[model samples]
Target: MSVIQILIINAVLVSIAMVVLWLVSLRLKDASIVDIFWGLGFVLIAWMTMAVATQDLRSILLVAMTTIWGVRLAAYLAWRNHGKGEDSRYAAMRDHRGGSFWWVSLVTVFGLQGAVMWLISLPIQVGSCETVPMSLPNYAGLIVWAIGFLFESVGDFQLARFKSKAENNGKVMDRGLWRYTRHPNYFGNSLIWWGIFWVSASSSTLWLAISPILMTFLLLKVSGVALLEKSLANRSGEYRDYICRTSAFFPWPPARRHGSKLV
Candidate 1:
């Protein structure tokens, strides 16, 4: 299939998926479930491309890496959010929309997400359509992806464990991966897309470069750092200190010892 054709088809698929989810949200009365499906949305697009597009080692690799990243994220979110009521963000949106929340959510939450996920999946769509022999970029991309996968997986694990501890209640997390950065998971997520871009891109496929760029922007500027900090800002003196010392996105060495003040 041609690139444009694949894009058109996947756009429709994504729209339909979101509509279905909207219906499910209505039944469950929780738009937060959409967060759990965010990763799976990309997984659907990747595998759909793999199934219909011409297959090559590179395409297969893209699908494999995407599945590894997507499935784990979705499952982890499901587990973490289990029994939790609607996420504050979505609940706020629902409250803001009043009686129109169903349609409002259809347009704002599910529809907007489907649109962005489709844009991000451009690499998988473009990359999987072309056949090529594996090269250095491919292997290099895999290595980078592995690094990101570990950071995301391990970082999430560390944070979850810290939060589960009774003594850590209301405390700022600054251990393990969090010690290096305030948002190791977001950093790892950015790396994952960039690494996938490396695997999928060539001179001809360079147009797909925006995939990782958009994902990085959304993570750093929009949903990831900006939104998260609003809640974390007033949590404690320890968190403020952690923010002072720890990098926001990229993993870096702490600028000061925990609980230390700057001179």
Candidate 2:
């Protein structure tokens, strides 16, 4: 199978999976499970791409890197989302749309997400399909992946800890990574894929063209930072104040708000 064919196959499979999940969600009355499936779906896509590609050093390296990323990410997201109810974003959509939610969600939510997933996976597909040897770019990709992984893991841990504490319950978390960026976890996630794309850019294919850009757009404009921050900004007063000081999607030194002292 050619690289393009492999990508199409991966996209179709994930789309079908999402459609099935959407149908099930309509019956089960929850959508958090979709989050778990989304993560796992990417792992499956990466592996499938590797399997389809002709055996070569590049293919092997791509598989190894992607598997490490996909597996860890899937596990973390699944563990975090376990037993949680529907994500607020979907729930809000359901509430607003009412009975029309079934169709709306199937096409707009599930289908759209499936397409984006495929777009974001383009770098992995391109990287894995081509033959290339170990090089500086590959090493750089690993370093970027490691840094992104740490940021994501640490950000998640800090937020989880804050939520678990009694006194901190329902409060905006402004310590640790959260103090620097409103969505450090998301920032890390975005960086990781860009790193993956950079590694893959060594490939003959130019498929990395869409991967990093799509991921960033999704993180900033679509579902990642925008949706979550919108909800937080509405619910938490401290969140608004934090936003005034902290960067939205990148970690940086907190800037002082008018009349507010920097900590």
Best candidate, lDDT: 1
lDDT of 2 at 46: 78
Overall lDDT per candidate, in order of appearance: 0.89, 0.78
Worst 10 residues of 2 by lDDT: 200-209
Model 2's alpha-carbon lDDT is: 0.78
Judging by TM-score against the true structure, name the best candidate: 1
Q: Each model's RMSD to truth, in Å?
A: 1.6, 2.5
For model 1, how does the per-residue alpha-carbon lDDT over 56-101 read when each residue is reduced to its tens digit? 8888889999999999999999999999899999988888889999
Minimum summed lDDT over a 10-residue window in model 1 is located at 254-263
Candidate 2, residues 67-140: lDDT per residue as tens digits? 77667777877777777778877889889999898888888877877887887888777777666666788778
